[model samples]
Target: MNNKRRIDQTEIAEVSKIDTYKSIIESLLFVTGEPLSIREIGTIIRCNERETLEIVKEMEKDYKNRSRGIKLISSNKMLQLVTKPNNSEYVQRLLKTNVRQSLSQAALETLSIIAYKQPITRVAIDEIRGVKSDRAIYTLLEKSIIKECGRLEVPGRPILYSTTEEFIKYFGLDSMESIPSLEDILNNFGEMSKNLKSE
Candidate 1:
């Protein structure tokens, strides 16, 4: 009986520790207002990355099941808390502006190209699009949807651009692998063109 009692106590302590960790994670995410890498979170919570990822995954499931207004989003092993997309309208209304404005056709095209062919140079993007993408690239950079990833190791050494974490969150993707296949995106391009023309 005493052994059973000790076992129960141990289990209770473990559960309490997990709960504490969850609470700490919630506070960290809320305060940071930015994505935190799993390793960073693990360091703070005093757990290994694998264990931290498991806890975060559990929290994500719980938040979804609870139908919470805020949800956890992750990409590139980084996690952040964000309002549900369905609640964007209310958020925008409160902000008195389109906080999540739709991208222009040019910007969308440029973003798509960068997302799929990341670390690509501007000249390469221009070659693919058959037009200079300076304006579109500028807009994407301003919006933080894309960023300078590096400079190509060529004679000219032009800067390379890649999609950012904000891009993943904007597209409601968990990771780069979550992006639709190139063929799928190509299939949808026709519809996108039609919608853009209509606008």
Candidate 2:
């Protein structure tokens, strides 16, 4: 008798119900909302780089055969999920790109600082970077990146600046908790103030 142990149907059913590879791929696909790279997908799913490539190959073929509403798109290192090209126009109308006004780098930076340290004041922001951020703050206020959170207890009762829901949406964050932490910001932010001073 062969000694190979058979994986039970229940186990198979559970795994099938929550297929690690497929689920991870779908999750990554959803996050990207466009073509994603194999490397990026693997990094997001915490999977082996080569294994992620294999998974995407299978996923792409499966979607093609089944004709699902969402399909896998593999372009360069960017693997994103998109509606079939035939249906892109309809989807585009439904989700038109917001072309009202875009923000500049200074505006985005001012917004980020307020976001990470909400209920902060202009003075505090200036202290951090050792420069006046009045223009940047005004720009952010105009863009609704920041709003008056509340009044502080000091003599001047300076208006505290905090990020708005629109700020979260603009930055693709689900909520405040979803925004990266201060430490994460330090790690990821690339010379935010240094560039600001140069400009």
Candidate 3:
């Protein structure tokens, strides 16, 4: 008699390659609820951006046909697999929780000033607001709503901060051109600068 080896064909008996891959996909999803850049996702997954992006796209297809509650969404240069908003009420009702944060009225005002006048310096923001915006700028940077666009070609060569891609998406704007008219700006503006100068 000859002895033969048997494979454990049970579905859940052993972890499969597909399962490992899905685990990676699931983990990538947990890193952020917002759409993440391919480079960022790759760094987390320990893979090249192209490979990670392909896997994500495939995972998105699988998610669509399955009963899984999460859906992978790609927008611009980012990818996000999030719980469908339609399920938000049920999820919230069951969890009895909400997770959200927003800028203060002052921070909002300061950011608006920068949005209209970037690539602009902090001093200019202070000039328009008539107050120091160090803290507000710090907050905006921390939130990734604004970033250092470049350094101004002036005496101090102050670092210029401009709105980030997140800023546009958060405001539901396609681009800066849609930021509203000067009249709209005037109406919404809280302060103005007397020595208005641009570099």
TM per candidate: 0.53, 0.43, 0.44
lDDT of 3 by residue, 1-199 (tens): 1222234454443446545655776776676444456777678667787777677777777888756777876654465666766788888887776522467766798899888888899999999999878767766775689999889898978899999988998778989888897787675553444334321
Ranking by lDDT: 1, 3, 2
Candidate 2 to truth, TM? 0.43
Among all candidates shown, the one with the greatest TM-score:
1
The candidate 3 region of ten consecutive residues with least summed lDDT is 1-10
lDDT of 1: 0.85
- Model 2 steric clash total: 10
Ranking by TM-score: 1, 3, 2
Tally clashes: model 1.
0
Q: lDDT value for candidate 2?
A: 0.71
Q: What are the C-alpha RMSDs, in order, of all predicted structures?
A: 14.0, 18.0, 11.7
Task: Give the better candidate number (2 or 3) by TM-score.
Answer: 3
- Model 1 CA deviation exceeding 4 Å by range: 101-144, 147-199
| lDDT (10s digit) by residue, model 1, range 42-95 | 998889999998888878877886568998877668777878878998999999
Clashing pairs in 2: 34-80, 35-78, 35-79, 35-80, 36-78, 36-79, 36-80, 37-77, 37-78, 37-79
Q: Quick one: best lDDT, which candidate?
A: 1
lDDT of 3: 0.73
